[model samples]
Target chain A: MATAAYRDIAIHLGVDAGSELPAQLGYAAALAAGCEAHLCGLFNRPCLPMIRHYIPPEVIERHKAECERAAVKARQLFDAAAQAEGIATEWYDMPGSALETVLVQARASDLLLLSGVVPGDKTARDYDRETLADEVVLALGRPILLLPGAPKPGLPKTILIGWNGSREAARAVHDAMPLLQRATQVTILCVDPEGQRGLPGAELARHLSRQDVAAELLVHAGRDRDAGSILLQTAQDRKADLLVMGAYGHGRIRETVLGGATAYMLGKMELPVLFSH
Target chain B: MSYRDIVVHLTLDPRNAARIQLAIGMARRFGARVSGLYTVPPPNVPYYMGEYIPTELIQKQMDEAQTASVSAHTEFMATCASAGIEHRWLSSELAPVEALRLTVRASDIAIVGQPDPNPADPASVPYGTDVLPHELALQAGRPVLAVPHSGSVTEIGRRILVAWNGKREATRALHDAMPLLRSAESVHLVTVGPERKGRTLLAEITEHMQRHGLRLETAIVDPAGQKVGMALMAEAQARQADMVVMGAFGHSRLREMVFGGVTETILSSMSLPVLLSN
Candidate 1:
């Protein structure tokens, strides 16, 4: 059988997905260099709606021009940075309807590097930032390597995977394979889990082992703490470079909307997150 | 890593023939043992009809299912013989999905079909029903390659597309996809939207794909800021690629499934199969 590894990677650029361009762009470039793969930057520009018939043509032209400026600006910045790193890179930029474009591109990308948001931030739009992250994750059908502002740079030396025996979590574990195998240590953290499936984390651990990922399974009580908070705490305590887990929301997974653990993690993530749905 | 053992769900539908062919092809490629987990569901009887249900009718129905099971087992053996691969058969009277789940060891990668959830389809099998592939992937503790029931694919992973991002999940998926890519004629690595500007991830991906001897080319597309999912689908179609390979979701299926976004869009609309690791 032929062995495989990543050949491509994508990063979200623009004020919409990530405002801190240098940190993420620098990070993505370094990642592309690490993998020795070509890099592609999509400079997306957020635009105001421009299809109104009653609006003056000049007004529409002005709006279009404004959006184009943003695209040009983002592209120029991306180009300069990509070139400085001496990386083979491509650039894509457009105005308005960026979310849809990004999502569609996600279909083709293996991993999407997105900017994580701090929880309780005003709506990224009319919606919550975490929910928006969910939309990106669901829409992309790709693993998301999410980085917060001022991301702690470099590959994850220590990783934490939140295990709950859900399909999403399983996907996350499998998706996180490349990083997990590379990491010096991996901890399977199960928080307040009922352990519904027999040998809950063992099989997953074995699966990782087969990939040469030495993992330790740790079950935490999660006493008086939400699963989201507990997971964050564990990641911080472990000094993990990456956190892997499934994004959960809606009735599609379980009945309780309750706390919206996945959403919380996306909003206030402390470390880079590798999420698989 | 190689999949040493593969378990393919065996049912009595016309599609099982194609499924078996694909599984056998994989077995041959990987030189792995293929186990046909044949399942026969008990006749559908009411939930709590104690004495009201007629015994003879139920018995007759059960006998028919058992007969079908025997036929399936025979087919499996024949197919295995023709393929000249190491094989085994394990048939059960338990509900097909549950039975396979129970019989399957955690280490074995499962091969199954994604039957149309619509009950109206003429080709649909009663015993082997919808969402079997998803359930197996979740329960089997192993990767599940889901072939849609509506179409047939004789070979898989020949000319492939690696939808890559530098995330660990994508990284993991790339590793899982290696066995298929190693033999592939071409591997296209692509990313959408803006570039991550992360050099380490891209460099590593190039080195790894090259090491496998895959004819690899990486590109970035401007979907002109279109819905990323549509952009991705268009790219896949444009290439005439056999399948699109990538990690499944970066979030839980619960919220994303409800919103009915990109992953769902691809699952429903993809003309080719998708190799999803996460």
Candidate 2:
């Protein structure tokens, strides 16, 4: 078996006064150390909308000062974390919308890491966490690891892959190969609808085996609406530290309406979830 | 990740030998097994005349198909045995399109032939089989390597040219070709489009590939009024790339068929082997 390594990893840093910046940097640094890769931290300093007529000058100055302060804090945290982990690191203090800045910077790395978004979490931009993850996954064409609020600084030991036999799922699996290869146990969880044809996850099992990844398959008959909860429960039961899945959406790229399972997972992600679109 | 199982679609065309040889070489490189799939289009009879067909005629058609499959199989076996590679032989009774769809499930990558529009030997590639490559690439859920009908491919994955447009399909093709690109001597990432601002995606990709230890020579080519596909092929030729790795189609098949897309142009007029994943 040829073990693959991710030599370049990027992390999305939300330049806010006080947030989960340290924890996010800590987890990302740990991963970069494990893979011996260069870690690039992208700090998004939100720029105010160019509507001077509507906004007052003092308000704009206040916002700019706040952004500058947060950017400094973010860089300090990132440098300290990377130094502690003793990994190669780079930092970019970009001035723009959080989503656009992160998307552009993320294209230069194999894997991306970010603290899971939540409502009222004081992120740099005024976008929801789910929206941030979805936009980057769909537009950037890279695998993103959404870390929980305060994740332990290390890689996953037991990984769970949500398989549905779609193109998105396949892409997620391949993108997560580096993590999968390093894990001690891997399980392919297939939640099939009432009466679908030929074993849902049997082919994926064989496919992974061919790549020298021996995976255990667990299938359950359930409705599509319950897939998200079922996968979460399975990961918890198996003690999986990482959840790998496809980010599904339909319609226009920008205005994508996520599928049920994808939406549910994004809203209620527990462990570190690696999502690829 | 490396391919563990490879399937080569075998037709009666003498070029079948080239496809098999390429597969064998790849199998040797990856330490994998090869499966030769032999399929022919159903006897060309009108669908409305289904039940009225005579038994002898059907029998005769079936026999000819069997004979073609047998000869192809014999050659496949001989080639693999001489190469001393682990291999399998499969002949499907199902429709060519359907058979390939099912067979590709067990394989990581599929090797198919570019349909010869004006085949010198009609028996080699019948009229209906020209669509198999496109069909398999789109529907197989696996990467397809389409070998040109007239190329003598002495080397594959040596000097490679990748068409990058920052689309979903292009991303898939790039990652799918990683295993091959890892061993290639040179890789050129060419983007065919007009100059535009905020296109830092290419620079980011360059940094990404550098992390993978692949030094990519990137170029931005303006189509300058030429078709995107034509410009891409011209770039490939100018670079003297032995193989072209690209995303199959950015547009839907129906839309591409009607409006003419890059995938169609490349499929219709490829001078070298191309690897595509939709």
Task: Evaluate model 1: give its lDDT.
Answer: 0.65
Q: List, residue by residue over B4-108, the lDDT tens digit for candidate 1.
A: 567788765666777788789898988777888877765666657765889887898788867877888888899899879888887776666677664444334
Stretches of candidate 2 above 4 Å error?
Answer: A15-18, A50-54, A118-127, A193-196, A251-269, B11-14, B38-40, B47-56, B89-107, B118-142, B197-202, B222-224, B252-260
Query: What is the C-alpha local distance difference test score of each model?
Result: 0.65, 0.77
Provide per-model DockQ scores.
Answer: 0.07, 0.37
Cα TM-score per model: 0.64, 0.86
Root-mean-square deviation of candidate 1: 9.1
Question: A102-168, model 1: which lDDT tens digit per residue?
Answer: 6655444556787666555565442433444567775455678777654655567899888876656
Q: How far is candidate 2 from the true structure (C-alpha RMSD, Å)?
A: 4.0
Docking class of 2: acceptable
Q: Interface RMSD of the predictions, in order shown?
A: 7.5, 3.0
What ranges in model 1 sit over 4 Å off?
A: A1-4, A16-19, A50-73, A80-85, A119-132, A221-225, A249-269, B1-5, B10-28, B31-40, B43-94, B98-109, B113-126, B129-278
Compose the digit string of candidate 2's lDDT tens values, residues A167-253. 667767878887887888999988888656568888778777777788999988997667777787788789888889877765422
Residue B105, model 1: lDDT of 40
Give fnat (model 2).
0.38
